[model samples]
Target: MTTITTRTVEYPADGLTMIGHLALPAGVDRRPAVLLGPEGMGLSDVERRRADALAELGYIALAFDLHGGRYLGDPEEMLARCLPLLADPDRMRGIGHAALDVLRTEPRTDPDRIAAVGYGTGGAVGLELGRGGVSLRAIGTVNATTTGRPGEAAHIRCPVWAGVGSEDPIMPPEQRNAFTAEMQAAGVDWRLTVYGGALHAFHHPPVGHPVVPGVGYHPRHAQRAWRDVVDLLAECLPVTEDLGA
Candidate 1:
C-alpha cells in the first residue's frame, strides 16, 4: 500500500459543525479528487477507511459528514433527520457543496478534475450536486436512487452510475423507474445495477446497531458495488499518471 496521510477536518454545513475525514496520496502533486459521503447514520469508520483506500490509489478523498460529527445509530433518529434532508434538494446540495469546497481548496487536489461517490443518503447528495450543475467528472452512488424535483435533472452535465439491491424495499421498482425516467428525459448518461436478492443497504457491512426492516448486508454484492464505483472513477477521472509513482 502507498504511504497516504489522513486527517480529521471540521466544516460547517446544515447549520452544524460537520466533521469529515480527508486522505491524501503519497506525493505533493495535485491529483483528481473525490467527495465521498456516508450513509444517513453518519460518518463512521466505514467511510474513513474508504477515504484511506482512495488515498492509497492516489486520489485525494474527503468523507463528508451528515450529522455534525454524530453517528446516529438509533433507527428512528437517523430517519428523523435524513428523511427531511432527503426531501430537499437544496439541503442536500448544501452539504455536498461544503465538502466540495473543502476538497477543491486542498493543495493536493486538481479542482477541475473531480468526482462524487457516496453511499445511502450520501449518494443522494452526489446526485444533487450533479443536478445543481457542479461540473463533476462523474457521479457514482450506491443504495440511493432518489429522484430530484421535476425538470431539475436536466442540469446534470455528467454521467451517473447507481447501484441498488433488487429486493430493496426502500428503493423499490417504482422509485427506480422514476429515477431512470428522469435521467433519460434529461438526456443524461446514466446506468443502474441491481444486485439479485439483496435488501436495502446491501453495500453496508453488518452493523451492530438497530436497523430498519429492509436493511441487510450482502458481502459479495458490497464488494462488487465498490469495484464498480472505482471503475467509474477510473474512466471519468484518471489519477494514475499524476500519482508521481
Candidate 2:
C-alpha cells in the first residue's frame, strides 16, 4: 500500500467555521484532485476514510464539512439546517467554493484537473458548484438527485453522474425525471443509475441506532455504487504514471 498523509483544516463558510479533511498520496508533487462532500448529518469517519482512499489512488482528496465541525444525529435538526441551505443556491455555492479554495491552494493538487463528488446534501452542493459555473472535470453524486434552479444547469461544463436508490423517497421518480429533464435541456452530459431494492443512503454502513424511515444501508449496492463512482473519476480525471506508480 502507498503511504498517504492527511490533516484537518479549518476555514470559514456560511457564517460558521468549516472543518475539512485533506489527503495526499505519497511521492506525488501534484495530482488530480477531488472535492468530497458528506451527507446532511455532516462529515464523519465515513467521508474522512473516503478521502484517504482517494489519496491512495493518487488523487488529492479533500472532504469538506457541513454544520461546522458537528454531526447532527437528529434527523429534524439535519433537515432544519439542510433544507434552507439547499433552497438557497448561493449559500450552497459558498460552502462549495470555500472548500474548493482550500483544495486549490493545496500544493499537491493539480488545480486544473479537479472533480466534485458528494452524498446527499453534500452531493447537492457539488451540483450547485457545477451549476454556478465552476470549472470541474466532472461531478458525481450519490443519493442526491436534487434539481437546481431553472436554467442554471447550462453553466455546468462537465459530465455529471448520479446514483440513487430506486426506493429512496427523498428522491422519488418525479424528482429523478425532473433532474434528467433539466440536464437534457441544458445539453449537459449526464448519467443516472438507480439501484433496485435500496433505500435512501444505501451507500452508508449500518449505524448503531435507527435512522429516519426509508433510510437504511444496503451493503451490496453500496459497494457497487462506490465502484461506479471510482470509474467516473478514472474516466474524467485519469491519474498519470508520475502520480501513481
Best prediction by TM-score: 1
The C-alpha stretches of model 1 lying farther than 4 A from their native spots are: none
Q: Write the per-residue lDDT of candidate 1 for residues 76-115, one digit (tens) a residue.
A: 9999999999999999999999999999889889999999
Q: What TM-score fits each model? A: 0.98, 0.98
User: Residue 198 in candidate 1 has what lDDT?
Assistant: 91
lDDT of 2 by residue, 106-142 (tens): 9878899999999999999999999999999999999
Residue 52 shift from truth in candidate 2, angstroms: 0.4
Q: How close is candidate 2 to the true structure, as a TM-score?
A: 0.98
Error of 1 at 44 (Å): 0.4
lDDT of 2: 0.94
